[model samples]
Target chain A: MKFIIQRDRLVHSVQEVMKAVTSRTTIPILTGIKINTTTEGITLTGSDSDISIQSFIPAEEDGNEIVEVQTSGDIVLNARFFSEIVKKLPMDTVEIEVQTNFQTIIRSGKAEFNLNGLDPEEYPHLPIIEEANLFKLPTDLLKTLIRQTVFAVSTSETRPILTGVNLKVENDELTCIATDSHRLAMRTANIESKINGTYSVVIPGKSLNELSKILDDTNELIEIVITENQVLFKAKNLLFFSRLLEGNYPDTSRLIPTDSKTDVIVKTKELLQAIDRASLLAKENRNNVVKLLTHDGGVIEVSSNTPEVGKVVEEIVAEAIEGEELKISFSAKFVMDALKALEGTDIKISFTGAMRPFVICPLHDDRMLQLILPVRTY
Target chain B: MKFIIQRDRLVHSVQEVMKAVTSRTTIPILTGIKINTTTEGITLTGSDSDISIQSFIPAEEDGNEIVEVQTSGDIVLNARFFSEIVKKLPMDTVEIEVQTNFQTIIRSGKAEFNLNGLDPEEYPHLPIIEEANLFKLPTDLLKTLIRQTVFAVSTSETRPILTGVNLKVENDELTCIATDSHRLAMRTANIESKINGTYSVVIPGKSLNELSKILDDTNELIEIVITENQVLFKAKNLLFFSRLLEGNYPDTSRLIPTDSKTDVIVKTKELLQAIDRASLLAKENRNNVVKLLTHDGGVIEVSSNTPEVGKVVEEIVAEAIEGEELKISFSAKFVMDALKALEGTDIKISFTGAMRPFVICPLHDDRMLQLILPVRTY
Candidate 1:
């Protein structure tokens, strides 16, 4: 294989594909990124069985030359070293050629690198992406959905199913939910889907996070297709594939309280900052528990006490407060994450009682909701 | 004790003192910062036995009210908790009051923090500074001296004395030197001193690093005093004290070769980048060894090879090459650090032979010099 390509284009493509490469894998060849050159373009692929990313650099784009292919072949190079070399190459154009015994030579200006490459025939093939049953969603919206719910996923391995965000599509709406049995985050979006029936699948939170980093914050559409055990996200010239987690996700809909005895509306930024301060001394606790007390004059007090450290009390005026006054204790980190994820000037919190879980949502938008289980405090 | 102080000034002072506070300390009280207030101003201090930092915020500065001290008293608060609380407070002015039983109340806007304060009597006193014999140096100059020599200090604990930078003052000049046996860095600077004879001491590299962080990048003169066991650096309203290392420092003046058989003059940035690229594949080796081969007409090749990984070769044009052609290998990280620390566009490197230690110095200036022992290659 022999090809000359722009250094910048190659660097970006290498970085995008490198996101899927893992250093520790059962198959040693999987640690290397597969590079293939065709008359049309060159493709770079990195995968570790769980997730795969493929980036293609076209030969010509908008009449501008990006790659010149002298021959078409394939070779696999160590992703870790190749990525570093391509990024630090001296010139705008780089030449790559494969010799006998899989020795690949990369030349740029006065610098040359001879890298040991593996035979392409020994590498595994990429997942066969079936384009049937495709659903298109704007890139920014998909990123937002992932950001709002992914943080709530369980980091523990005891309950493996809770480590993924459950995605349910029904009636032209897409709902994303993640919970760690302590806190739950749910977001609904009106996706551009024409399918009739409901489709449900649990996508690992880690996969969504890596996919988010590769995606640009543009409003362009990204086509997503889910099979029995794999999901594929296809953009302009990029393909991302993630393996689905095996198991049934828990039903958390009934856990969210439908009615509340007390309701409060407060500025999101103000509440977030207050809890952040209260958590300073409370961080030693298991949950970093912070207590909230409601007053009659539309005022709420946030407080936390760590016996040996100290205590902190913060008062923030609520825009509106109704029903009976109540005192509740919850993890400050959970509430802060929810406040930051839901974008708005103000948020509404509805509480059923001190022990029951409470729900928080943006006052102006009803699409995103976060629920937190109150901790039992003495 | 009660005082209302500007939050910004307090925050800066807290950060300055926090540099000396460490969570892991033999003396438990050392983890707390001692705060003392007089009619004139308020003082904040943090000490970890090895080093101590004190910052004073006066009642008035340039006709501006920075602090209003209603009463005078002393208390010690947990540095970790107090620092976090002060940084996240909401108001421009913070009111601190000591109630009964060492219970302190810190209030800002509608937020209040009740912290447990220790007895100020238990906090260790700062080192007594002898100002009779003092040396003054510009903050920026001192920072430069530290940056050039500190990095060469030994990170290994086999020889504790080598972990410090030796300072020698004589004939109205201060010379600083540091070496890890394999490499050495020496820097000389002219000082404004009237003291007679020579004053030599070994300042711990870790202490100089922390002192460098506290100092501002200004030309203002700072008073430095070195005694038998302690060194004190006095800035505007800050006092930094560090314990000096014991035992005599090794004389490495003869390590730097006075003559050379091969000389090369090259742009600092060009050679640095070339070696960086070569080190990409060579990093698996203990020293990340990179070899330099000089050609007849001012061109040199920098290359590195790992049998299993690959090899990289870079050709760079030098401004000048004199004497016999030679091949030398050195650690890429050492050369890069020296290149980054020195302020120059072009540098001159002198090699005695392929195995002898080489000297590198800025072409236009002779105040700073670096020496590296070549690694033996098979």
Candidate 2:
């Protein structure tokens, strides 16, 4: 493969594909990014066993020559070192040439790097998904959905399916849910779809996070294609593909309570600060538990006590309070996560009792909700 | 201690002192910060046996009240938790009151933290240094001197003294040297001292690093006091004390080469970039060895080869060259560190031979010098 490309364009494409390059050396070819030159343009692909990313540099962009290909061939080079060299190269244009023996030479300005390239045929090919089941969503909305639910996914690998965020779609509405049994986060958004379809899939939270990082917050629409075992996200000239988890996602609908005996509405910032202060003391305890007590008339108190770290208590004025007064204890980390996922200025929390689970949702929106199970504090 | 201190002032003092607080709980009291309130001001001190930092929040600043002292007393609170609370408190002023039985109540706005304070008598006392043997240096200069040599200190505690930077003062010049046996860095500056006596002391690199971070880039003069077994740095109302390592530091003067068979002058930036590029491939090898070949004319060739990672060769045009042509290989990390410590745009390198030691110094100054031994490559 031989090509002369603009340094900025090559660097940008290399960075996008480099994200999927495997750090592990079990599959040596997986650590390299495959570069393919053709009459159309040049494509760079990087992949591990779980996910793959491909970025295409068109021959021309905005009437400026981006890629000039002398021959069409393929070679795989080390992803990390190549990306670093391109970033540090002190020139506006770079020349890349691959020999018959797979010796890749990259030159920009006075700096030239000769990297031992692997046969592109040895690198795993990205699974192709038919475009029949594709749907479009705004990049900003997709990023927001990922951020709100991804943090709540189970980090432990005990239940492999729980490590992914469950995506459910019906009609034109998309809902994402993530939970670790201790706490849960859910977000729902409306998107423009070509047809009414009901589908469910679990995409690894880590893969979604990486994909979100690569997707800029532009008005551009991302086309998503779902196959039996893999899902593809295509935006602009970038294609991100991830394999779906092969286990059944646990049913979480019954875990969310349908009713509550007490409800309290408080300012998000005030509650966040109070919980934060209480967490300072709670962090010293084994369970990291923080207690919340709601009294008559819109008064809420957050407190935590540790024998070695002492105690902390803070009062927050609630917007409104209804039903019976109650007290409950839960993990400060779980509560903080639930509070962060909330979007509105004021949040309404519903409690069934001290021993049961409680629901946290925006003051007026019911589409997004978080549930946290209270710990039995003696 | 009973006082109402401005939240910002209290937070700033807490942050400075907390740097010395021990993260390990082996010494319980060392993990706590001692707060003392008197008619003059409020003092916060934290110590971890090796290092101590004390920051005083005066009762008033610039004719404005900063702390209101209602009672004179002292208490020790958990440093980490207290600092976190103070930083997140949503109040302009914080009220602190010590109750009977070592119970302390800290209130700011609606947030109240009741911490279990320890008896002030249990806290370690700061060493009192005599003013007879003292010197004054600009804060910025002191920070710069520390940064230039600290990175070369040995991290292994096998030789306790090698983990510290050796400070030697003779006549009006103050020189600091640090070496891990493989490489050495030395920096010298002129300072004003009250006494003409020669002084040598080894200060722990960790403590100096923390002290450097707290010292701002200002023209303020910092007072240095050398006691029997401790060194104290006083800047304004802040006192930083570090215990001296109880051993003799090895002499590194003989390691620096006096004369050379080859001498070369090159732009610091150009050489740095060449070393960086060569290091990319060299890093894949265990030793991270990069070779530099100097020709008769002023041309220097940088190269590195890793069987699995390919090879890199780059040429840098040197300003001047002398002596026979030679090739030498050394750790890329050492060269990078020396380059980073250098201040001038142009650098002068003197090489004894291909197998001998070399010295790198700024082109127009002798205030700082770095020496590295060549590595044998087969």
Candidate 3:
């Protein structure tokens, strides 16, 4: 097998696929990046049992020749070494060929690297995904969806189902929800990728996180297909496949409260900063809990106290405060994450009481809501 | 203690001293920063018994008020907490005051932090050095001296004395040497800091590294005062003190070769890159050994081979080749480090034999020399 390729394009594709490669894979062949070249292009694939990423570079892109003097062949090189070699090549173009005993030779300028490669026949085959029921979402919106809700997914294995984000499509709307029992993030958007029927799936949060890193924030559509055990996301020149977690996601609809005894509207930036400062000392607690108290006249005081460490108090003016004056304690990290995810200047926070869960949303839109269960403090 | 200081100035000073503070201190008070205020300014000190750093923010600088409404007092606050608080203060001016029981109130804008402070009297005192003799070197020059030799220090604790950089003054010159037995780096300069007599000391490689980070790259003179057990570096508003290593540094003068069988002149950058590529496969071996051989036509070949992994070969054209043909193997890491430290486009490398130690120096200068003993290959 022999091919001469542009070093930069090869380096970029290798890096993108490398995000899904795990060095800890017990299966030796899984540690390698399978390289296959056809008349159309070269495809580099890296995967573990749970996630796989494949990137392609065409022989000719927009009349520009990217790869030349190529013969169709297949070989797998150790991802780590291959990535480093392509990045440090001395020239703009690199030449790679395979000799006897599956030995691969990579030549560029005056440097030549001979790698003991693995047989492509020994590599695992990517599941053939059918071209039916293609559900699509714009790249930027999908990334935003992942970023806004992925952080709330459970990192604990006690409930493996909670470790995945739940996606539901119904009534021409797409809803994405992530919860770790203590906090929940829910976002609903009008589907830009019109579909035929309603569907639901649970995708591992870890997979979505890795996929988010490789995806560009563009309006280009990403087609997704889900089978019994696997889900695939297809973008231009790239394919991402992830294993779906087994088990049902817990119902979180009843977890969010519908009414509140106290509702406060405050500047998102001011409240976020105040909570951040108040939580500085509370960080030792790990839960990072802080208290928010509504006072007379439109003032809110945020504070946290760790007996042996110290205490912090931050005050911010509220645009309006109504209903009962109250105090509640919850994880400062949860509130801060929710605040950062909201793009609006002002947010409306509703608290039923000190112990009950509270809800926060943008004043101008209700497309997303974040809920956090208050921590019990004596 | 009470002072209203410019937030930026306080932040910078705190960051500088915090580098010397370690959280694993057995003495609880050492984890806190000792803050002392007088009519002149406020001094912040942090230490871990071995290294101490003190930064002072004067009451005024360049006719601008950096600190005001200050009262004389002393207190110690946890370095980690204090550093984080000062960095995130909401306003340009932060107010810090000491109340009863050493309780400290730090207020900026609408944020207030109450820190559980300790008595400054309990903090460890830095060693006292009699101000009898002082030697000075430009800040940038001292940093260069450090960068040129410190990387060769032995990281192994088996030979404790080899873990330091030896600094000696004699015959109107200052010489710095560091070696890990396998390799030695020697640098010398005409005494810019005029002295009456010769002096010698061994400074811990770790200490010099930390000090290098805290120092600015300006040419302002820094005063160095060495006592029996301590060395102090004093700048305009900063003081750094590091304890002297207990044992004498190893003598490496006899290790450098005085004569050579073959000499080759090559572009420093080209040689460095060739070794870098050749070493990519050698990195897994940890020792990272690479071999170089001279060819018939002013050409040098750099290569590395790992039994089961891979191998790389690179060739570079040399400017000159003289005396004899030779092939030598050495740690690629040592050669790369020496090449990076030398500031010359063309370097003359001398090889005494395949098995003997070789020396490298810039063709036009002799202020510094690097020697590396070749490794045995089966």
TM-score of each: 0.99, 0.97, 0.98
Model 2 residue A326 CA deviation (Å) reads 1.6
| lDDT, candidates in the order shown | 0.93, 0.89, 0.91
For residues B1-378, what per-residue lDDT tens digits would candidate 3 score against the true structure? Answer: 789999999999999999899999999999999999988889999998889999999998999989985689999999999999999889999999999999999999999999999988888788888877777888988898899999999999998878988888777677889999988888887755567677788889998999999999999999888787889999989999998888777667777788889999999999999999999999988679999999999999999999788999999999999989988888999999999988889999999999999999989989888888889872
lDDT by residue (tens digit), candidate 1, B1-378: 999999999999999999999999888898898999998899999988888899999999999999999999999999999999999999899999999889999999999999999999898888777787788889899999999999999999999999999998888789999999989999999887676668889998998999999899999998888888998999999999989899999878778889999999999999999999999999899999999999877899999999999999999999999999988889999999889888889999999998899999999788899999989983
Tell me model 3's lDDT, rounded to 2 decimals: 0.91
Error of 1 at A250 (Å): 1.8
Evaluated on CA atoms against the true complex, candidate 1 attains a DockQ of: 0.90
Q: Calculate the i-RMS of every candidate, to one decimal place.
A: 0.7, 1.1, 0.8
Among all windows of 10 consecutive residues in model 3 chain B, the one with the lowest summed lDDT is: B190-199
Task: Show model 3 residue runs off by greater than 4 Å.
Answer: none
> How many pairs in model 1 have backbone atoms within 3 A of each other, for residues 3 or more apart or on separate chains, i.e. clashes?
0
Task: Tell me the tens digit of each residue's lDDT in model 2 across A117-147.
Answer: 8988888777867888788889998998899
Q: Which scores greater on lDDT, model 1 or model 3?
A: 1
Per-residue lDDT tens digits for candidate 3, residues A274-312, read 998998899889698899898998999999999888999
- How close is candidate 1 at the interface, in terms of C-alpha RMSD after superposing the true interface residues? 0.7
Q: Judged by DockQ cut-offs, is candidate 2 incorrect, acceptable, medium or high?
A: medium
